[model samples]
Target: MTANSPLANPADPADRGHLLTEQANPRSAQLDRLSALELVDLFNQEDQLTLAAIAGARQGLAAAIDTATEALRQGGRLFYVGAGTSGRLGVLDAAECPPTFCTPPDLVQGIIAGGAGALVKSSEGLEDVAEDGAAAIADRNVQAHDVVVGITAGGTTPYVQGAIAAANRRGATTVFMACVPADQVPTEAAIDIRLLVGPELLAGSTRLKAGTATKMALNILSTGTMVQLGKVYGNRMVDVAVTNTKLRDRALRILCDLTDLDRQAASDLLDRSNQQVKLALIMHLGHLNAEAARDRLAQHQGKLRQALEARVSG
Candidate 1:
């Protein structure tokens, strides 16, 4: 090849050679040449890898759940930090915690590089600013009790790396989620989760398989933590906020299913407990008034099952 040609001999940095997410998939070498149906079929095949990737990371994911649950039980917060599509996914997961689990808004937060404005636009450049990630951690006053999860699809986003380091210095537990091998771009987090779904169908576009895997991982992390913290009871969102018609119906259904009460009776019980499903269930099963059931729940740190057991055993 000519010296000026694109194929001319060059030194490839270690970072450039090891990233699996950026590699071209042999299966999709002719991605652009495929028919519409072929492309759809290929995409579906690639997506299946995402689930397997999560399954592989089960141990690390469980560790993350434990760390986050312990931190939250100690009155600490949970933070999801990432950039671009990764950042948006973190933000979406954190946003859902409030209504679904009745958590305070500040209990779980998402920090995206380039701020909230970057959610809609391409803020790719900001991911390289490692210092900003550290600053974002400081901005939130992350402490020893908090758990911060840093997500990077290719696993080398400097911003995520920076956030993880700062979280370490602050004594907060750090969990790292990436879509590449640990040897490629290690984050040295307390809990390191690798979602290895191989190369993207469209080359370096991680928004496909990598994005889905990351979203599923975050969902498991947050939801599992909430479950440990007693936000759920018997597969029901006992702490769900009845903010709308659908949620009201769900709360009523949970009551009826658990207590075998008719619709009117369940609705009345929900009102008596101030529309709190957990309190309503507690009051019914423990054979106590709403105030007494609430006291028991508080004594048991919001764990409904334990409170009911204590009431039964006492």
Candidate 2:
């Protein structure tokens, strides 16, 4: 390639070929020769490593959960930053939070290198721009109470690294998630989560095992944080937004299972509570009207169990 080519960076000295996520898997050496069923079996075997990787990073994940929960409790926001598949996964998780936990849209956000367009089409070339990542953080007005999570499978994405560095300067709690080890790619994040899923089955394709592991980690992080925030009651999504028929049915079922109400009565109560399962439960269990139940919930910080317990003890 010519030195003047836009893709050529002759002065850049970073070499990512040695990263664990970039290595070729010996078991997949004969990938092209495998039968369809064999390929499926081999993939199943390799996927087991994703579970082990999650287990290995359990402590770090828990720490991130705690940090994020505390930040949200204090009115802080959670932001996930990345590029490519990692970025799309972050955006997906952030988008699901509102419907599942009745959170505000801005409470959890996703920042990709090329913005929303990258979620569908490939804008991988944008991942190389460190300044763009830093600018994303600045534009968001990230503050000290915010939590910023930087996800990069190879742990060398300049965009993610730049965002983390910018977050640190803004005094936000930073969490870094990667498939590589610290020895290979270190970070200044408050919490470092290494999935360590090793090489991909397709040789350097991190969208495979690494992507799965990241989704699992994000599931735990977001769910655990919401639980700590009192969005759940007895393992049920109490704060679930009844935005559709399916969610309304789930809310009704939760009421029937948790309270003495049957299907019809639960449906009536759900309507009375403005389709809020938690509020309906509080109204029934605490013997309060809709307004009083809302007051109790506000007093108890939206914790259904705490609101009921305080009423009983009173």
Candidate 3:
């Protein structure tokens, strides 16, 4: 369906310009005759629009993060539901959360339209079936405390809408991230994030501007949410899970950077803390053992910065 189509409207004043999504780009024709360098420059120029779109939706994004953080703190999960490129981006973000923030695998999840196989292939047809989306949420056993985010560039994907509807019915906090304006969003979402990235360079192909904006919004949502939840200490990713050689090196670097400790000392602390980067930092910086660090962390509700400050004052 085209952007101007009547089915896309949801009676929201903040979304009037959304119906002109197809007309948002004036340089589409120029791309056909552009040289390689010109195309690269054009892409870079369009990329700037993505950041502007996110800035416009910062308040909504912050609200979504706050709601999601509270749910997560109460032992709830965060689910990303989408299709096509949006789905793949969600999967990518969810996959990184575990290693970057030390979250459990089940704590953050991605549910694409056609399941795991859809990640590597096109599942465009699956997006048309709202029932499939609802079924996916049900199968995941989504609970009331969970937060479900529906991502769609056009804001009218039946699959994502249906998933958000189901999640809402289950008492989950439903958030919608769309490149189009808010009016294009269905009634299923509790918080609507309208990231107006204008139009695509290739006519209706949202993978251009729309996809880039969606990725940026997701990055902010996930990363900012993690930071607010105390997974970070100051500006450092203290909760990083050092699972592999590269991450192990990064953990040691973080420890050394934060504590001014030598590499050997950081490595020793990490080993003692079972490769938990946050605990290691606390143990070294606060001059505490593993158990003491754990207690301090718990006392401050897992906030590394607060725990460290408390240690200093004590």
lDDT of all predictions, in order shown? 0.89, 0.92, 0.84
- Tell me, by TM-score, which candidate is best: 2
Task: Give me the displacement of residue 137 in model 2, in angstroms.
Answer: 0.3
1-314: candidate 1 lDDT, tens digit per residue: 12342212222445465579988999999988999999999999889999999999999999999989999999999999999999999999999999999999999999999998999899888888777998999999999999999998987777887888889889999998999888766556889999999999888899999999999999999999999998988788999999899999999999999997999999999999998999999998888898898899999999988898888799
Which sections of candidate 3 miss by over 4 Å? 1-21
Rank ordering of all candidates by TM-score, starting from the highest:
2, 1, 3
TM of each candidate vs. truth: 0.93, 0.95, 0.92
lDDT of 3 by residue, 247-283 (tens): 9998888888888889998898889999998888788
- Better TM-score candidate (2, 3): 2
Report the lDDT tens digits of candidate 2 across residue range 1-314: 23343222211435677889989999999999999999999999999999999999999999999999999999999999999999999999999999999999999999998998998899988998766888999999999999999999988787887788889899999999999999887778999999999899997799999999999999999999999999999999999999999999999999999988899999999999999999999999888899999999999889888988888899
Q: The CA-based lDDT of model 3 is what?
A: 0.84
Q: After TM-score superposition, what is the CA distance of residue 43 in candidate 3 from its true location, in Å? A: 1.8
**Scored by Cα lDDT, where does model 2 land?**
0.92
Candidate No. with top lDDT: 2
